[model samples]
Target: MKSSVIKIALILLGSYLIGCQQRPHADKLQNATTKKIIGYIAGWKGVDTSAVQAEKLTHVNYAFANVIDGMVTEGEGRFDQDKVNIQKLHSLKSRNPDLKILISIGGWTWSKGFSDAVLTDDSRKKFTDSAIAYLIRHDLDGLDFDWEYPGMQGDGNVFRAEDKENFVLMLKSVRQALDSLEKVTGKHYLNTIASAGFKSYLEVNDLGQAQQYLDFINIMTYDFVGPGTDTTAHHTNLFNPNLNGRSAAQAVFDHVEAGVPIEKLVMGMAFYGKSWKSVRPGNNGLYQPAVWNSTHPYRNIQGMVGQDGYVRYWDEDSKAPFLWNQSDSIFLSYEDPESIAAKAEFIKTHNLGGAMFWEYHEDSDDGELLNALFQSLRK
Candidate 1:
């Protein structure tokens, strides 16, 4: 009887240990929270957004699902997309009740309203109020301010003195609103922003103040360089003195030094490739005519064109992707899955917030990039 009793006690102790090990850590996401952050972005949910596929990938924690129309300056809005996205998001609640679906407003092209809206309290109120309504309508868990920048323009924007202070104020106001809603609903909501790549990207902004409001910030780390009117180096890569600025590993360091909490920073990855063509073949210098091409059709040295009448191709040496052609000799650079995995590891090494991607479609459907990221960086 004594021996049997001792064995039972041991068994109970072992079970307790196992349970303790399973407990969530400070940084380790709760099963539900983890599922919400490991999200994907398809186009708009109103369209065929592969919502089912996303659900299949339900282990993903956060879904910054589509609802652009709702944030629009006019007309139907992302509200048109809200019902469908929310329904889809609701389906995931059964499996991941804590999973968060954020409405990411603004994009490479959709940032025009941001500058105008944030310039005044009334417009800011209009934008934020509409945003809250949209979130309420669709049952979203948070909002991602993806404004390209307060003052940046196409080649990417330079910072302004006003942007430094006003930006933090804007974030604080949004956070206050979200917190108010949280108080009433007892539902957790996230406040976040998507920033740019320059080492001094947010130089004009106050990260310390911003961090107080933001849950975290997603740094748009890719597209460091792209073809526009000229060949340029952009995107993450081993530095070559021969190339240009846009994309460089150093940019990551830049943000960290700027006082952004490394723990609250999620390195953004790119799954696509930028292409370019050499004006002087075999010279390995100068590319032109940038095209948005992903699958490199020819060898790294070779090139192809799309219906848009622009040629595209890749560069192997940089370990970065790009597009270029003879006419324009424009060089574009981007990141692929392999580089993305490396970035994920970088995030892990720094113990940063984790990782985020620009959009879901840019990734090759195998989930290789994000999966590798999950494996490398998951807490």
Candidate 2:
């Protein structure tokens, strides 16, 4: 009888422990389905907070706070303006209390000091302390590191091989500091990074270790066909089977292979388009050589489509759209409502974390692209 009683007790204990383990997993699964819509707001563009559609976004990463002399600071000569912009961004919380505003430091231009800032423990602490202080002073929710390209030359920024490890260490220190702050303020803070979409970036850094310290990794999936590229292609295509080129689908796969969890990966979209001049007329100007290239905001691209001899064409394989102007030999690659809906479907099908876009103002005043994202992701 005692043996049977003990056996029953063992079974009950096992069931209790199994239930305990499954509870957290169930919560994680529930949170995973709640997608995030992150938008990068350019503070330099003079953020008109009133115009910002805060209700549609889950997070807004303000670009950018700069790293100066091993410390975090507002951009040089723009401190006053940055302070006002941050204040304005904070006011947006009134519209959507759940909205999270993060300060993104070290953009393409301001990433020069990252190498020296996190070179040693003391420097890392200094940088971390200043970052935490900035957050506290601004009453911000978190920090987003946008180190252009660690261990790689980006916009003539200083870089070293050690940057690969230091980058992880930097994130760890900041995460620890944020945790300590949470203990005092009773509020949780987030830590995220804007990672490059290219595979070369994964080769240099260890995202497997880095993700442990991050809440989300926002990949810049656009700019695949950047300036000086002789061939014109999709800058932010969801898929590209015909040509072996960069695509958002490929980038997400690379990140997953690089050890980033699919639940923490936020797919990036472009709110603007890339334009090339003097392109060959074959394939509706797809994969053709061009002499000059420039950027066009979505607001402007909307007006240009089907006007002034510009014809819009869709590549079914790539799941992308483009504009061809045979008279001007101008080819444009960009995302429209159709492409945005396709990407949103991709995100849902793959169970990705969510979506992020660059520069809020690039979208139309009527919030065309943002509405597509909200309807697809939020609704």
TM-score leader: 2
lDDT of 1 by residue, 200-229 (tens): 556656676787788887777766555453
Residue 40, candidate 1: Cα error in Å is 5.1
Candidate 1, superposed: residue stretches over 4 Å from native = 1-42, 45-78, 154-161, 232-234, 238-248, 282-334
Q: Please, what is the whole-model Cα lDDT of each candidate in the order they appear?
A: 0.56, 0.91
In model 2, the clashing pairs are none
Let me know the TM-score candidate 1 reaches against the reference structure: 0.69
Q: What's the residue-level lDDT of 71 in candidate 2?
A: 95
TM-score of 2: 0.91
Top-lDDT candidate index: 2
What is the alpha-carbon lDDT of model 2 when measured against the actual structure? 0.91
